[model samples]
Target: MRKWGLTLLAVFLTIILTACNQNDSKDEDKKETSEKTSQKKEASQDESGEGFKALKEKELNSQRNKKTTNDSSDNQIIDYTDKQKIAMLLFQPGLDDKFITADDVLKGEYQSKFSDGVKKKHLPKLTVTSLPENTQMDNTPTGTKFYNIQPFPSQYSVNIAMNEHNMIIFGSQSPIPDYNELLHGLDGMAKVYKTKDVIKSEKDNPKLKEVEDKVDMQ
Candidate 1:
């Protein structure tokens, strides 16, 4: 009976040890799997360039705020309500680089050209405004004459393009403040499109002259 009891005790100890070892193996596997998942998640975020996108969004918000002159010196408000037009910063693929620059878009340096891709990529919010009664779409807008009115000299090169809808997309890195400095902004409140009919557009739409004047200066 004593020998039998001893054998049973040994068997019980062996069973407990085996169970503990199995549990430990499972825990190690789970830990390794969790680590790999974390690594993959980090890699995906880096590839998508979410950091730059987030920064660009923040900058846009800052630009869209109502124009104020009394703000702290740290920030220069860019919204110019007198212009009655939207003045906001745009981001290129890289958040650091502005889509438009002030230096590259010298007067007569570039001409208006219709690009469908430009519309989709830069100004997805662009809507088709009616052309003047006599004005028709210049299929080759590249040939159309675009007068460049200098708002001010810029520290960085300007980037600009035109869309099929006749809206001009201009970009500059300089921040034109809305209060006092907005008049000096590189591309302060430039209109996205222009009209051809002086009578049809201007005759019909009273704001045509105002829009054209603003575009000319920008």
Candidate 2:
């Protein structure tokens, strides 16, 4: 009877120990699963945030390109050949002055003042001849006299000329941020030609004397 009791007590203790170990293992597995879920949620949030940022950037760029395209189209339709004569004058008055250098002229304050002055003048028969260095005169009207007034100290100057029919288009440039604006301004000043006007002018003023004089000189 005593041996049987001891055997039963040892069996009960062994069963209790095994159950405790299995419970511990289940608890550990639950903890590992929860940790993995939390990490996945964090990674998903990060990816979503990055995607939103990329979308916003793409939208901004699209708007910018659209604006640029519209402006370019408007400039392209401008008529620069309508006028018989056109003149452009650009004066950077203090550009080469002792107190102001080319670098100083590029400042915002100076540019504003210069641009405002040109706009206010609004000369009908003048053109601003301060084109970019890379500008080519291939399409420019014949007999146009482009002068760099202050050729040495400043890159700005005036263009004066008569077109084939003696009609005049005067243009000027201010410190405009957009090149399209300047081109449009020039196009505005050019006069549209009519077939009748050309025929009438030629009939009224024949070039016989002019042709004879040129022939003699040659």
Candidate 3:
């Protein structure tokens, strides 16, 4: 009976040790799985942050490119700077017979100006102003007609008309911003026509000359 009791004690001790070893193995597996899951989550967050940064950079670059294209196109238009050149473009065609009409001047190409943060085309509105009865000439029996333009409220005024001698004259209240370029564009549309030589504005057409001088805008 004593030997049998010692054998049973030995078997019980073996069973307890085996159970403890199995529990320790399961705990180690659980720890390893937890560590792997944490590493995957951190890697996913890093990838999402990198993608968002790349998208933001792309949008900024596209906007910069669009602005550069607009600036380049604006530079392509002509710029004016001279007064005599502008006057010659508007001068009467006494000997050469180059004739420019009000419609041609109105349709001329122009540069743009910025107003209230928006780009506005520099186009002028043309209106025909009739002279007094005394200022009327044989060529213009009713009255001398002048084309005037004062497109912008802040800018100066300009007038163009034929005098009693049939000579074309150009006048302005003050210096125009880009008159040279504007007139040059108008010159491109001039038509050649035959009119008798009458350059008498300085010598004999005093009344019409005075009306021409008085032609201005408010």
The Cα local distance difference test for each model comes to 0.37, 0.38, 0.41
Candidate 2 stretches with Cα past 4 Å from truth are 1-11, 34-147, 151-218
lDDT of 3 by residue, 3-30 (tens): 9999999999999999999999999999
Candidate 1 error regions (>4 Å)? 51-218
Error of 3 at 110 (Å): 55
Q: Could you tell me the TM-score of candidate 2? A: 0.26
Sort the candidates on lDDT, descending order. Answer: 3, 2, 1
Candidate with top lDDT is 3
TM-score, prediction 1: 0.24
- Candidate 3 matches the true fold with a TM-score of 0.24
What 10-residue stretch in candidate 2 is worst by lDDT? 83-92
Top model number, TM-score: 2
Please state the error at residue 71 of candidate 1 in Å: 38
TM for every model, in the order presented, reads 0.24, 0.26, 0.24
lDDT of 3 at 116: 48
lDDT of 2 at 137: 40
Candidate 1: residue 96 lDDT (0-100) = 23
Over the stretch 167-216, how does candidate 1's per-residue lDDT look in tens digits? 24334454323312222332443424322211223233444333433342
